[model samples]
Target chain A: MSAQDLDGGSDAETDGSGEMPKPHTIRLELVDEPGQLLAALKPISDNGGNLLSIFHERGSLTPRGHIPVEVDLECPPDRFERIVEALREAGVNVIRAGAEHFGEEVMVILVGDIVDSDLSDTLHRIESSADATLQDLSLSAREGTDEASSARLRLAVRSGRVDETLSVVRDLAAEKGLHVVEPLAEGSQ
Target chain B: MSLRLAVLGAGAVGGSVLDLAGDYGHDVVAFADSSSSAVDPAGLDPSAVHDRKERDGVVGEAAPEAVFDADYDVLVEATPTTLGDAEPGFSHVERALADDRHVVLANKGPVAERYADLRALEAESEGTVQFEAAVGGAIPVLSTISDLGAPHVTAARGVLNGTANFILSRMAAEGLDYEHVLAEAQDLGVAEADPTFDVDGIDAALKFVILANVLSDGETEYALDDAEVEGIRNVPGTALDLAAEDGRTVRLIGEATADGVRVAPRLIPQGSALSVTGTQNIVQLETKHAGQLNISGRGAGGPETATAVLSDVSRLE
Candidate 1:
């Protein structure tokens, strides 16, 4: 799957300077063959994830007879997800990934020709740029897009970034000639 | 008052949950058996569904994947346990969490094998995963530890698998051999036809790994292989007799800590806490401040296990 398909770039980017690396851990199940550990590690290193530790339970086995290995690494949140996808693509069984929690919620409404204007792209952009995930959505196209349409979206965002998420939605709506209904009820425009 | 639900298995556990969910105020919107699946966005008729599945041997009209796209608040994974890769059960969880739906697991494969991956999926989505039925059947051992808090839980050890415990107990009590007791247990339906997973200690070890992960705050998780396992296949009745004469009994014990996990036969003095017999299960938690806590009850049953699955579903807000 492409970068957009996995999480739609919903993770926060740590590309800027002075950003501390996020500590991420991935537990993987590996086949009992030589170089399996190396093959799994390659994805993390290749994807710019700095390795912190590796714990390969060579003595133990999962129910499927594969060895379980835990890798601790540090990278920006988005890079972490890429490493996970890469590991999965390489046929490594990622038993677990990031320990970070997405704990904030925000609700917003978009009005105007939402259906005709590629709402999917707008949703993807908001997720990618605002570090938010779509929780629940209710779209009202009762009168059809030729006249007017609106969508209510419930989003789970990274903690303390509700305003940043709303602003991203506002910008997307402005570009699409859509009106906004803010979660805080700052008066729909 | 009514919460939407999608059930992934129509077997014993699934059937019981389907029957009891109404009492808990949950509407069964979708359901699936091994051979087929059915879904209704407006909520399915329970009696009609039961009649169809019992008489016609089918539940829903669509494939299992269709349930993911259907409207539901939580997905109850009640499929058969698939160890190693944790298949169809894992896939079901993947799709549900990806769709941002809460998950309640009755299948042991996903939670025991792919806990970390499931947690990652839960973190990314607007959902959470719970699997009280995975271990100790209806015992509620996992939740008990969680309620007491994990930090206070330094170690969790128990007789997790009922089949193994039952076989060992019979051998020790009757002074019978392992094969003889195992054959009898199989006849009684306590042991499966191929009891390697249970007799070989893999089943108990899986539960050990899960508890180890939970106690360590999901930091240190051991695989089934990581556990130092020794099944009761070769254990002699004389060993049990020997321990019995000394006021001790031999039991299959699984212990987990931050350092490691192991499942093997251990000698516990008779009348002591760990010497549970029959098909009963026990989980003893070694706490740092709250003292040691031991919870024991019926470990595995269709109705008993369903209660855990239902409890998990109710936990989802």
Candidate 2:
């Protein structure tokens, strides 16, 4: 199944006893150092989380050269939170804990010197700014950094925080000298 | 699947359990009430025992102590709700869990007020405790939360006390005062003659305390005393009318967050999930992933609660 389906649709899936064990996807940014994967999975299992699958993007690296791993696990909802807490307690970098719950999808077009402004840093800042995460992005900088090129950023925000998240994006774009085309307030101008 | 059960408190819930256990492949081996009890290694006939209680006003030849020594795989405690010290019921659960027998409780007393003690008892025994009926009657509220796990269920809010809700609903719907509605509730058997427990918010507080404890996975123990309780006694019909004028109605709400538990009459906007009317109960769980999940149903009744107790028994396997 797709990752989104597993996260949001687990309540409909039940074991033989008619009780649904929640499926959670924990996104971790692991250091390239050895034993990082083992270190991450240990906390989940120790806390009674049933591991479903682990997608270790070994070849890929974050801007910090850390490997991004997505560990899908099945547990009661309470244990899922504890497992996330436990992973954090174990000093694992949790990039995203419960991504599926972010229901509000807002796409904003940033028009400016997109590539010159350190796009990765911008994305990281936005992810850390609020209860929002970068779901997908289409950055087109073929016209070069000196000229104004636009990037389409799709953000998955926590439900009901769309307005707040859009404001954060607005402020961020204004500070970065980027013009924003917000999906929500398209009528304003 | 001939599961042996020792049932404590042959009241409404307990009696319904005995009546229904056979349908679920369970048999009541031992049964007890306040005055008397009956025990048999071979399962006791529920009809015979019930008849004895009706015909002779006592449960056969055995005494209440016989339940503790009875041979059973599971203990179902459907005792009356008790408050301070959570006596008799607490002791019964302790004995069962300490004896390595699984416990399914309809009694809210021990689970709400003495959770830590019960946890200690559970840890020392080979049994685990399940009390789905304690919180929301037949709603499967606790089981739903338990299944969702605490990580997803961030908060639990509900209209828990039926008598209080009934009184409030009538107070708002018919413009009757609390005393008048309460009297109607009493006449209809919805409110007890001594409705102090249900009307004072004690019962709802107990349920919320239990929910808080369950959400915390027993790490954070909460007692009824820990809850901030406000009953419906002080709620005037005029206040409800004023709220309705503003498109709102009041519900006796019990809420439990990580911070604490509280039971008080609160204004619910019209058509909101919390604005549930009548004697119905609604438990809304705010989840991290699943959004808000609401379960509403008849929150109290012998047969309804017995269904939860039976489900807990089946869950033991």
**What local distance difference test score does each model get?**
0.77, 0.79
Segments of candidate 1 deviating more than 4 angstroms: A1-189
Error in Å for residue B82 of model 2: 1.7
Q: Compared with the true structure, what per-residue lDDT tens digits does model 1 show for residues A9-32?
A: 443331122344655667899999
| Model 1 docking tier (incorrect/acceptable/medium/high) | incorrect
- Model 2 Cα lDDT, one tens digit per residue, B77-155: 8888888789888988888877889998899999998999988899899999999989889998988887888777888
Tell me the tens digit of each residue's lDDT in model 2 across A15-112. 11233455567789999999889999999999999988888999999999899988877776557778889999999999987646424566665666
The lowest-lDDT stretch of 10 consecutive residues in candidate 2 chain B is B237-246
- Which stretch of 10 consecutive residues in model 2 chain A shows the poorest summed lDDT? A10-19
Off-target runs (Cα >4 Å) in candidate 2 are A1-189
Model 1, residue A124: what's the lDDT?
A: 75
Query: Candidate 2: which pairs clash?
Result: A77-B148, A77-B149, A77-B151, A78-B149, A78-B150, A78-B151
